[model samples]
Target: MGHGTNLLRRGPRTAVAAVAVGALATAGLTLGPATAARAAISCEVTYTGYQWGSGSGGFTASIAVKNTGDPVTGWTLTFTFPGSQRLTQGWSAQWTQTGARVTATSPAWGGPVGAGSSFFLGFNGTWTGSNPPPTDFAINGVPCTVNQVPNPSPSATPVTTPSATPSPPPLRIVISPKSIVVPEGGTAGVQVTLSQRPPGNVIVGTGRVAGDTDLTASAPVTFTPENWDVPQTITVTAAQDGDATDGSATFDSRSSQITGSSAVLWTAVERDDDIVP
Candidate 1:
């Protein structure tokens, strides 16, 4: 179990800095507070999931935490699985589970997340009955606003923007079942679509961001204005490894034409088939 650390502890200004400010005031100059006030820790978290099989099944969960307030030297995210989702393996953080509760602590090389920056962590789990996304999320004991990304339906219509500009909605690439389980010698697919229609032909590029090098995603797929609303599938294949442990990888999808639209992240877990009884 890893614990988060914050070197910037809250306290009073140093005496030497205060004395220098006092001298400056006597010289006809004013100085502000020696230490800047620390902003409250606030965050926005997005939870996305993808599942396969029936009855007792396996799924992947991807969580994105955006530091909306102050910079976090490190962070600990805690949440509960609405269903009987037991963690099998995770990446990008130190993961632990106690019954239904799950905790993810920042890794040694994954910390010091700055304000306005976001970090991603996910896991492969098993679930029973129905799988529902968790509504409660907290970072460093502070509650976070959770945004759930819903799966896009096949009959979904294209969103039309008005000619007269009002406040434009946040642009995003829609990826359904944002996570997948790829067997060590097999592949999995995820759908990619645009939240709104593009002006012309838009190219959707896919690439691996982090995780196991043995897992590879498909090449870039293009979606034109004529079929922007239709979902396109991206394939992820896992290469066989000698180890028996499952491997995970993160892939990103971005639209070449949609300005200000951030890349959407998805995770792939390799189901190692080399384990013996």
Candidate 2:
């Protein structure tokens, strides 16, 4: 997964160097600290506001929408006028004004903003006395960072970003028949399953219980798993002594080559096997 952040794409910044100082006021967008998210779909807007003299006849505002995290399909720009500024006309997109709130939607041609790319639009507005640029901006229902002008000129260095990568699922093992009882002279079969294919060959090992005088166990002490899809069966034969009253012996079946080596250790109740069991 890519972080979607890379070399900053420069079109036209919000800062107006050509306009005489004091004659125009910048949008003064706020570039707050980056927010943490499960998937960073961060977006940002850079605005340039030109005030006509004393903001008596309203002003003209241009906005460039940028995708800082992931790619976006379309944009629905929304903002609120701080003062009595009312939108008069807009170009490059269709806009709707509701009281002091305004919304702009992308036109038929442009709206898809790829990661690290941006688009811009401008609108004219009217004011009674005071005209102030909007402090908040959201695109497509997700709030975007309001980036203020760094200075008259943007930084020359390109921002380096790290790509995102997802983690793989963990390895698992399953076995059937946690415990068992063998007849006087009978045998039982147990199934061994793997969660997924092993990184390499896997081996199974069996250990005999101590002081098992009346019971004898016969099981495929060692095994080489053929594949992940197929399950391996281990036959366990036991010898029952009539002289002894139900003598019991226990055995362990474990994978020779497993992840974390000693992470999984399972004990069968009667004659059990496998990871889950």
**Top lDDT model:** 1
Instruction: Tell me the TM-score of each prediction against the true structure.
Output: 0.43, 0.39
lDDT of 1 by residue, 165-198 (tens): 6866765689989889999999999998877767
Q: What digit string (tens of lDDT, one per residue) describes model 2 on residues 1-277?
A: 1333322322123234445342422322222234322235677898877665442665678888888978766578888898888899998788989999899998888856789998888899886666656868888767888865432211223546676666566655555665656555666656766667667666665555543544443443333345764777655565544343444556566664765542333233232222132
- lDDT value, residue 61 of candidate 2: 84
Clash pairs, candidate 1, are none
Q: Residue 59 lDDT in model 2?
A: 68
User: Candidate 1: where is the Cα deviation over 4 Å?
Assistant: 1-39, 151-277
| Leading candidate by TM-score | 1
Report how far residue 31 has shifted in candidate 2, in Å.
Answer: 33
